[model samples]
Every structure is written in structure tokens, then in C-alpha cells.
Target: MDNEEVKLLLVKYITGEATVQELEQVKQWISAHPENEQYFAQLYETWHNMLYLQPAVVNKDNAFNKLSADIEPKQPSRYARLITWGKAAAAIALLTAVTATLYTRYSKNVESVRQIAANPGAIKKIVLSDGTQVWLNAGSKLNYTADFGKTTRTVYLEGEAFFDIAPGKKTVPFIVNTKNYTIRDIGTKFNLKAYATDPFFETTVVKGEVSVEGNIDNNVHEMSRIYVKPRQVLRIYYHPKKESYSYTAPDTKNLNEIQVSEIDSAKLDRYDGWKENLLVFDGTTLSDIAKVLERRYNVTINMTDAELSSIRYSGSFKNIPSIEKVLAIIKANTAINYSVSGNTVNITRNNNND
Candidate 1:
């Protein structure tokens, strides 16, 4: 979530409307990192103190003068009572804040872990423990242990991301582990994106090289291993029929092997274009194009039906500003109809009867 969403959810938790899932998210956000809990506790205490003073009565005016003239009066801290939960029937805000703290339950031995965020439609950038740079793809996740850079720098990835590794002379091999595979790099820049619904796992090298391997295959021959060269791609697809695996096409059709007089450039930009926020679609089905556009723009690109998915167009928007003009030009020339709604874009067939 963005900062506003996080703040709003915390406020909801504070006021009490957050559901179990939201409460779980809040707990995860808070406990994921030590600094989060510390910073949040300070804010929580300050807000709690302000509201704590609302219900008050004077004990004694001159009583503190017995100890010291400058001594301050002791006010009860509400949060110190972690076990006890009291009603905040005061205001909506107060009730919300209190309910956030009061109703939630947690495991006794829960070692604190705060989530590192990658919002559904947001891009996240991070510096790895090894001084490596990483741009996490949208709708993805990455998690690491607390002492990240202490002994070793390790991370877990859920969706897709690109990494620019810092040279470390193989002191500790930098590793990225996915659901079914793992990629190890001594020092290199590369991209790894395993399509959720698609069958293949793609590792494209932009600058240097990487060694990728399967996780489950015990038989050495059935195991898939590949070393991708600079500007090359290694694709691994698992076949359930043979219960085996192998390396084959780098989307060979996409390889700029033959020059075309009509096109401006005859090459795939690899991860650089995609990482730099460019979406290049060439005769791709609308279904695949929708997925690509959704990833590129972080918007829902929907089609009218399954038949519309087969629509193919060839064009390259090296960057995003060219996208609006490109789409407008396509619709102007073709029988496709399209309209933009906020971030979402809907594509339909232009009636041929007219």
C-alpha cells in the first residue's frame, strides 16, 4: 500500500472498522520491522496521551511541591496496560484507535516481522544488503531476515524483479530463490520473472551472466541448468507429461535475426525497456497485450470477450509518452474500439455492419 493507505488502515485499526484481514495486515506491517514498531509506538503514545487527558480529575495542586517544585504530575499511560482493554465510548476517532489496539490477537511466540511493501499497482526500489540495486516488479513481494547484511545478504521473491548486482568477488554468492527455481550470481545484472499462469520461468541477462537451476528435479539429466550470455535469455519450461525439463526458445520469433525494411528497429530491448517503464508489443494477442499493459502502466486493461484476445498489432513504444498516440493511431486505422477510464483501458470490436 501507499503511505496514505497505510495511514488510513492504521486509523481504521485505531478507530475499529478494520476487518480480520486488515488487522492481520496491520500486525504484519507493524511487526515486520523493528523500526516500524518503534516509530509507530511513539506516534501511538502521543495520540493516546492527547486522548488520555480527555478523562481527567485533579489529584492535588500543591502535592508535587513536597518532592520538587519543578516535578511534573504523573499521568497513567494507556498503552502500558497491554493486557487490559478498556472501552473508548468517547468519539469515533478515539474508538477507532482503541479498537485497533484492543480487539487484535497475536501469537505468543511470534518473532516480530514487518512487511517490506510492494503495492499491487506500485513500483518499489530497494538497496540489497550487498549494496546491489533491485527494482521490484508490480504485484510482487520480497522478504528477508532481520540481520540482512550482517553475515549474508539473502532475499525471497514471489513474482518478478530485476537486479543490478554490486561486485563482491564471490565472498557470499548472491541468491534469489523463487517457487520452483533459483538463480545464483557472483556479480551481474539480470531480470527474473516467473509468469503466474504461464508455464515458463524467464531469466534475461542485460549486462552480465547468471546460472539458473531447477529446485525439485533430483535426477541430474532431468534437471535444467543454463548459463545465459549478455543480452541473451534462457527460458525453462516444465512438461508434466514426461515429468522432465529442458531449455529451448528465447521466444526465438522475437529474436531480431532478420532485418525488416518497414520497422524502425529489429530487436528486443530485453528487461531494460520494461524496467525503464516501456511496453513494447509486437503482434501479441490482446490477452497478452492486456497483461503487458497492466504490468507496464499498473492499470487494468480489459477486453470485451475471449475472441477479442486474438487481435494482433505490431508497434513499439520505446517509452510511455508514445503509448497514447500509438493506441489512438491503431484504433484510427483498425476496426478496434477503445476507451480509457481512469487507469483502466477497455478494448472492444468496432461494428463492421456500419
Candidate 2:
């Protein structure tokens, strides 16, 4: 058979509309060449991402025209024609899903905002409309508009996420918005932790460069903007006023703090290891480690003794099923004791000060 026939068969295969004979033929073709299998994989991912496009944007004619331009010469060999038909069918199916769903669920008046959240007990990996890949840590949320990657690419983030962005687009630069700061990427890979409850926000650059911009509330201009390179971390602290004194006393709320420092390659990798369900710590305080454990295990950790909270810990855990194992490791290394009550774990110093 010619290329046109093969392309048609491939399209039918993707849409699950192919007959058993056609399916066998396509499978044989795929198995014949390694590059053929890779091509099919790439097309599959493209089709998957295309499904998320806004309804208003996708039209049959527009999609067909675009596909035609890419695979030129209207009249080609049967084999080539078949490939084109399969590709076009895949694109049409993706566009159809968006348009059909939009008519029923989404309004055309407002741009749809897509939110991908990792619940307290789960971690999620998502591919944004712009093809940027994100691995969200537990209790983290990532939101972006459906019209993303059109004129501008922007995403709002709460909690922690590791982003591997596509190459720089002059018109649509990738921007990650947190509560306190905005990270603008110039084709970079970075891990960001920006939980609202946390005292500080952290951004660790793994590759390329990212410019971070900070602004005051409702301000038209940015307060500060700084660029971060690979193997470096930028932390911004939020300090709220704790005391209210006499009328004569002035309010003394510490301004947000920003700190940038170089991190070792080994340590930087550990920082990004949360996506792999690995927890690695180096000299991390028990207080801070407790927060990490709480998020990972979806449990409450209470430190009964203040001294025990300050104890430094260093360890690595790989998909350990039980929290008791983690506490046992800590207890073995330090003078700390822990008790589990229901879903809560209480830690105290072994000296019986609490």
C-alpha cells in the first residue's frame, strides 16, 4: 500500500476507528522501525496537549489549513496522503473535544482558567497548555488561563512546583506568579516553593536564567526585579507584626526579605527530588523537616519540646511507606522521642523537659 493508505490507517488507529486488520498493519509498521515508534509517541503527546485548547480558537477549516501547510503538495503519493489524513484526524479529534465541552460547560465571555492541584495526599505531574511540564508537590496548586501561550504565558502558583519550561518565545515569555514575587523565565528550568502559610518563599534555578520581579499590593510598577542563575536559590521572607503596644509605639512589621545564595550541585538536585517521591535533607532543622513530612504524609506533626524542634537532621528517604520509619531514623540519630496518637505525631526531647 502507498503512504496515503498508511496515513489513513494511522489516523484510524489513533481515533480507535480502525478495523482489526488495519490495526495489525499499523502495529507492524510501527514495530518495523524505531524512528516510526518515536514519531508516533511525539504525535500522541501533541494530540493530548491539543485537546486543552480553547473552544473559540479551534475550527475545522483552520485546523485543516494549518495541517495542510505543514504537509504540503495537496496531491501526494497514497502513502503520504494516508499519513496526512491520520494526523489531521488526530488534530480534529482534539479540537472537537474542546469545542464540544466549551459549548456546554464554559462561557465564551470569560477566558477559562485551568487549575491543577495536588491534594494533601497526592502529587501530580501536569503539562500546561504551552507544553511546559510541571511536577506539583502535595498541597500545591497551579493555575493558568486556557488562552495561555497565545499572547503571553503566565501561571499562578501556590505551594511548590518544579517547572521545565519550553524554549523562550519573544512574544510570550513564561511567567510564574507567586504571592510575593513573579518569576519570569527565559527558557529555564527551576523549582519553586511558595506556600501561603510558609514564612518564606524559595526559588531554585536548575538550568538557564530566571528574572524575579516583586511588587507592592495594587502597585503599577515593580518594587524589585532580580535575575537568578543555575545552582542558586532565592528566598523571600514574610514577617508580620506580632505585638500591638501603646498608641505612642510605632508599628514595626518587618518588610519582606529576599536572599540569594549559591547552592552546591548535589544539594540542588536534592531540592528537586521531591517530584520523584524522595525526601533528602542536609542539616535541616526538625521544625522545618516537620513541615515537609506533614505535607508529604498528609498528617499532623506536633513538637512538644521546643529544644527538640531546633535539632538539626540529615537523612534521605525513598518512598518509605510508614511515618514511623522516619521518626525512628530521627530518634536513632538524636535525643528525640516521638509518640503517635491517631493521625498526629508528637515529638519531644528525650531529657523529659516537656
Candidate 3:
């Protein structure tokens, strides 16, 4: 509607490549601006004789009638007749296609600049430019720009991921972040477990070391200071309204800080094992296992009996964990019966006994 947009629309209109929305915008502009009408009239008159066969060669009256019929404002206009008889039909199709292409291209150009990413599968792996490997857990996304490895290795992550960072020289660093905190990778193979709702941010480092900081006015500690050594799983609680506490700082009051614990490396591997096409589990609650199963298989898992969800599980599965095996195992451990209809799995108690 403005002058610059009007100029651009004119170019698009002439190329027969304006979208339906753009076409409406141009039409409205042309209708509103009397000066635009005058300008087009002058240009039309100048280009009128430049356009087609001379009126003297054909029957002038008939030729005029044909042109008037072709250029009817309510229907296909003179622009449509501009397609020559040699390849008129093909030209019309190509023009319409170009219209859609240009519109889509323009919209995409506007959108791709913002670094939008979506997870298409249950477990997806994204290898970054810096030789770092990211295993996007089910329904997780890692978003960054193409300008990543050159200036900085910064990315925004949603959901969970296991990052095996390539060894960084003493200078360059690898970082992963959620809404609450930042996990600075000290060239470590670590699994970060964080949900958008969970109050605690947990990281288990299997190899090398890692430092985690909470977002307390950018100072980095709320729950505890984690010096994540090999086989050590560091748990840090995040409080939205609390201040950061740094353990390494001099003259700290409480020396008995929350110590990071070293668990079985194999168990940690089982947690991060989604990278190798395996869904490994330790003595996790049946409900927790059900959530993992739902994410991996893309299904809805519901347990009506409260006791059925309380059962703990220890197993590994890949390529769709068999529902029968899992349910049978749960039934043996607890008083539960289950059935699978289509992709839905329903679990109920066999007897309502305490």
C-alpha cells in the first residue's frame, strides 16, 4: 500500500507471480490511489501499441472487441491474453506456479532467520559443526543458527538431550541451556534431565567434568555447587526467587554443601543410552517407564489404577518395547491386568485390594 511496496508489487504483478494475498493488496492499492491510476494510464497508453498486433492488419473493430473481452476486469484480464498462442496454456500454468513459489520463498526467507526447530521423531540425533553430538530425546529440540561454530557455540534446548561433546581445547567451550540454567560442558559426556515443569535440574556426567549454574540474576547457583566427576550425577535444585550460592568462593559459611554422588557408570549409560538405539532403564517407577514408552513409541499410555503406577521397573528396549512383555512383567510384580487395543494401552487392577 505504501510507495515502496507499490513498486515491488508492480514488478511482481508484471512477472505474473503475485500471490492471492499480494494480488488483493495491489488491487486495493490501485483502487485507492488516483495518482497510481493516472500513472498506470500513461504507462498503459505508452505500452498499448507496444503490446500486440496492429489494428490495421486485422479487422480493427473485431480485434478491439476480442481485446475488450479478454481484459474484462471481472474475469481474466489483458495480462492473461499476453500469453502467446504458441504456448499459451503452458505459460499460464508456469506463471501460476511461479506465483506460489515466490510467495512461499518470501515467507520462508522471513521465517528461517529465527532458528526454528521441531522434533520429528522419538529419538533424533543432531551433529553440530564443532564435532559435537546431540541426542535429542523424545519430543526434544535443539535450535541454533548456521553461524554457530564460527563466533560461538550457543544453542537453546527444549526438553532433554545427551551431549557427547568433542574435546575442546583449553580455550573454546560447549554449552547447553534450558530456561532455568546453563550447563557448561568441560568436554564431558553428560546426560541433562530437565522438564519444563520440574523444579530440579539434574546432570549426570559419565566422562570428564561439568559445571552447572542456576539463573539467579546470572550469578549461577541456587540448589548446590556441582563438581561433576566421572560416574558422578550432580543434582541441583532451582528456586525462581532465590540467590546463587558458589561453593568455590572464599569464606563460605556452610562447608557441608550438597556433594555430587558417583553412581554405577553402567546405570548412567543406561540413562544416556538412547543414542545407541536403546531405551535402557534402571529401577524406575512403572509410571516413569510408561512415560518413556509413550515418548519412544508415539502412543498414549494411561493407568487408571493408582497402585499399578507405583510398580518399579528395570529393563531395556529398542524398536518398540513389546507391550505384552512389559505388562506381563508389571502384572507379575503387582495385582494389575492390562490390554492393548490398537495403539492404546490400558492398565487396571485385577482386584481392588490393599
Better TM-score candidate (1, 2): 2
Model 2 residue 78 CA deviation (Å) reads 70
**Predicted structure with the largest lDDT when compared to the true one:** 2
**lDDT of candidate 2?**
0.67
lDDT for every model? Answer: 0.54, 0.67, 0.55
Tens-place lDDT digits, model 2, residues 1-354: 554465566665543346667877878877765435544543432332232333235555554444334233233332232233345454344334433432332232123667788988578998877788899999988776666776457777878999999875553568777655668875789999987667777899999989876532223223245778999998766564455311221111344566788999878757899999899989999988998898888889988777777789899998888788989988888888888877799887887432
Q: Residue 178's C-alpha lDDT in candidate 1? A: 60
Residue-level lDDT for 66 in candidate 2: 41
Q: What is the C-alpha lDDT profile of model 1 across 102-184, one tens digit per residue? A: 32311110122223546655568888767889887767666554545543344556667888888774434576656555577
Could you give the candidate ranking by lDDT, starting with the highest?
2, 3, 1
lDDT of 3 by residue, 5-90 (tens): 55567546532345667767766655654434433333222222212212124343454444343323333333334323313444
TM-score of 1: 0.54
2 against 3, candidate with superior lDDT? 2
The C-alpha stretches of model 2 lying farther than 4 A from their native spots are 1-111, 216-223, 243-253, 352-354
TM-score of each: 0.54, 0.63, 0.55
Q: Root-mean-square deviation of each candidate, in angstroms?
A: 19.8, 17.4, 22.0
